[model samples]
Target chain A: MSHVTDEVKGYIGVETDVGRCWDVVERGAVRRFAQAIMDLDPAFMSEEYAAQTPYGKPVAPPLFPLMQNRLPYDGTDVISERADDPDYDGTGGAGPSSNLPPLPLGNLALLNGGSEVELFRYLHHGEGLSFRHRYADIYERETSKGLMVFVITETDYLDDDGGLVARVKRTTIRR
Target chain B: MRDNDAARADAPADPRHFEDVSLGERLGDLQKGPFTTPHLMRWSAAIENWHKIHYDRDFTQQHDKLPDLLVNGSLKQNFLLQIVKDWATPHGWPWKVSFQFRAMDVVGSTLFVWGAVKRKIPLRDFGLVELELGIRNQEDRQSTPGKATVALPYREGGPVPYPFVPPSADELAAGEARAEGA
Candidate 1:
């Protein structure tokens, strides 16, 4: 396996520049998302049905961008360190600093823990999307097994018209 | 009545009305064989997902250090949609669906897709039903969790149901919480 360090720096504390456009949503793209996710609702495909909605175009399914690669986030709010023991659940009574586990050799190990996404609107078909993200939170906790890193990344999706479509905060557990 | 036999057999019956459904009713479960390279490939082709990790095991091994082919994130989401829409076919569209990717759904694992109605809300013209939904592997590992809201008939006789309005995040979270409790 490639050392975790190589991919760690690329993913951890990484941010996309302002106005960097990601062709995150389009008509074909939305249709594909709808098809991929097995959502057969005609509203996602029928121009007339979607036109009745607020967006006035066939809208992409709510979670489409997440399926795309090259996610962007703001990295200003990250904290990294080696852990003494990495198996601690983040539910410790104290605040982030005290409850954090040790970091290991500045070596990064990360995996998808889970996330919460809030959608305000759908990405209308054929619309260009630009987004930027930020490191919402980062900390470490110790456990009998080893130390692990708890990282939260937040990505904001915007349309070419500059309206917010959705926001997602993904938490990754790195050991 | 004797003359109506041919007409009755030829004409398809109307979809079941939403009024016929009850809370906690199941749509029946769908099971797929253990995941495999071909299954993943078909799903990927259908969705046009080109993520290296999903198809290229070598890349996954070298870059992400993950085991065999990682399932497409969207595929799991698709499975949830399939389970819900199939159950709701009688009612028509349920407007909103939002879910989170919980864990990597790997190959060689059987998945059971299922859902149950939690409650029904009456609207001025139509009714909105909230659903608690999930997809799990054979080992009972939940791969995805989310909520769907469907529009139903206010009374026994109503206009053909239309696509439902998808629920907002708050609504989905509340529904998810309820499902967790169950």
Candidate 2:
């Protein structure tokens, strides 16, 4: 690990075109993710079961968006180039590259941090969801491991009623 | 409360007051285990997360230099949600919640999920409860940290009505057309 100056910029914000909103919210994708996660809960699969519940409709498991949404192709293609392009089977890895810019920003060692989300209601298949993403903040701190940079981002999801369905905040750390 | 005693605590001191909660209220902690590549495989297959970073170490190292098979960030978030749901259920508290991704949770790390209430509002239907959340690895380094808002049962009320749902037919069709064009 290398110790260096806090070369971190504050939050940056971006918007997803309305057209891409449905890319991840499809009913088939929702079912696939629900099964993949072993969330064999009946409500996620059965319309009849779901209709009996308070939701009165087939609902995807909570946290469905995290499972459904894919990173945009523009971003994915950029990383694929960096990963040197490898055969995929739904796992993590890019490839060996001595020179890859820092995640989002340039010149930093970024690590996979973690995130937390709250579900206002379980998302259902064929249900349309829209989101606006904003970078919230960045903090510089010292860790025993070394210098660390924390980037926090927030995405707001709205439903047909224009009511906010869920808001997801993600933070990543780079050294 | 003593750690041992808290461990054995059946429920919160008062259930109704759960809605009257404040920022300092400790929501307790939960432990998970044996998260492995197979776990990731199962989840990935189910979700169809074709992204290579989740499964291939060579791909990750060559491209991003990530450590061995990484745990899905969403899995960690699910763990957080499961913990909170488990903690609240004994008291018969069911709520609607919202959260953000704060970090990437890798394999071989032990996570301790905790939170504190940050704000509260009384909606006509339910209590709006907001809290700051944190998921720290065993190293005491916080991996992902963010905020959350939940719709809790009113102290004197029953349950909150569903406030968030998808758009209308016209709206969805328009969204579909826009998406296809894009």
Candidate 3:
């Protein structure tokens, strides 16, 4: 593995739009998501049960926005492009969640380290939601395997009124 | 908490009264999976990604040197959220939740997402409760461990403000002052 250089460290504080997509939180999507997580919260599915709650409407699961932002079609998709290369080791690819710049590391295995998230509100049915994403930071640490790099990206999900829904800081690891 | 038992057992929560909560109250365990290849693929499909490592055993083993088709970290996070989300339910708002995968959870492993009340801070209008949470595999090895904070309205204080609002710095200081005084 190459040393984590100054060029790589420069990516810190670098930000990208990662685009804004508008969506109406639908009941069907919420149902599927709740099922996928095995969380059968009525507030996410049963209209009669949800209307009795403070929200007065069915809402998406807490992390639903992560699913809403699908694979972006930038004409040359990093994930798809890398898939065509037979040598790809099934790592170091980006998904809809972050816009962190690709690191200088070549052909290293990657893992979704984990995340820290803050939720101020839920995305409810029929409400318009927008997501703002940016690469918050990048850093490296020495490991027994060698040197490893960690990428931190922050995303803010907002309602149409621009009120905050959730703020997420995701960590991706490369070794 | 096995995956099948917990899913079959969980019922809807009633609005929890702030007065009823106490330190060390167990937010009942949540179990998920015997997660198989199909379960992993469904999650990948749910998120609309076709990451070959999740589905292609040849690619994962021959190229990546992994033990098996790895369970999605994203999926594990969802299970972690499920525990607190349902625990808070109609009464309390799951204000903030976070966790990390301390070890890899491979395919065919069942996960038990568990949490317990850590601390409770009484606010003027509501109560903020903190808890330590984690997911453990069938073998009782813990993988993801983290903590969360939730806002629960007082039984008499009315529903948590619709579109929840986080305590500001000044409010937090005042709450701390109140907490110390109590």
Candidate maximizing TM-score = 3
Q: How do the predictions measure up, each by TM-score?
A: 0.56, 0.60, 0.90
**CA lDDT, candidate 3, residue B9:** 23
- Docking outcome class, model 1: incorrect
Q: Write the per-residue lDDT of candidate 1 for residues A5-27, one digit (tens) a residue.
A: 54443455656554434354557
Better of 2 and 3 by TM-score: 3
TM-score computed on alpha carbons, candidate 3: 0.90
**Candidate 3 lDDT by residue in tens digits, A54-164:** 777778888887767654454346666675788765433335553456767777677888888898877778787777767677778887756878878788877888888
Q: Count the backbone clashes (under 3 Å) in each candidate.
A: 33, 41, 0
Q: lDDT per residue, candidate 3, B90-111, as tens digits?
A: 6788888787766888889988
Query: Which runs of model 2 end up more than 4 angstroms from their true locations?
Result: A1-19, A71-104, A107-109, A116-118, B1-33, B45-53, B58-67, B86-158, B164-182
> DockQ ranking from best to worst?
3, 2, 1
Model 1: residue B44 alpha-carbon error in angstroms: 6.6
lDDT of 2: 0.54
lDDT of 2 by residue, B71-102 (tens): 76666666556545444432322344444444
Error of 3 at B45 (Å): 0.2
After superposing candidate 1 on the true structure, give the runs of residues whose Cα lies further than 4 Å from its correct spot.
A1-20, A31-35, A38-41, A48-57, A68-109, A141-146, B1-34, B38-53, B58-67, B81-104, B119-130, B139-141, B145-182
Range of the 10 consecutive residues with the lowest summed lDDT in candidate 2 chain B: B1-10
Output the number of the lDDT-best candidate. Answer: 3
Against the native complex, each candidate's DockQ, computed on alpha carbons, is 0.10, 0.19, 0.53
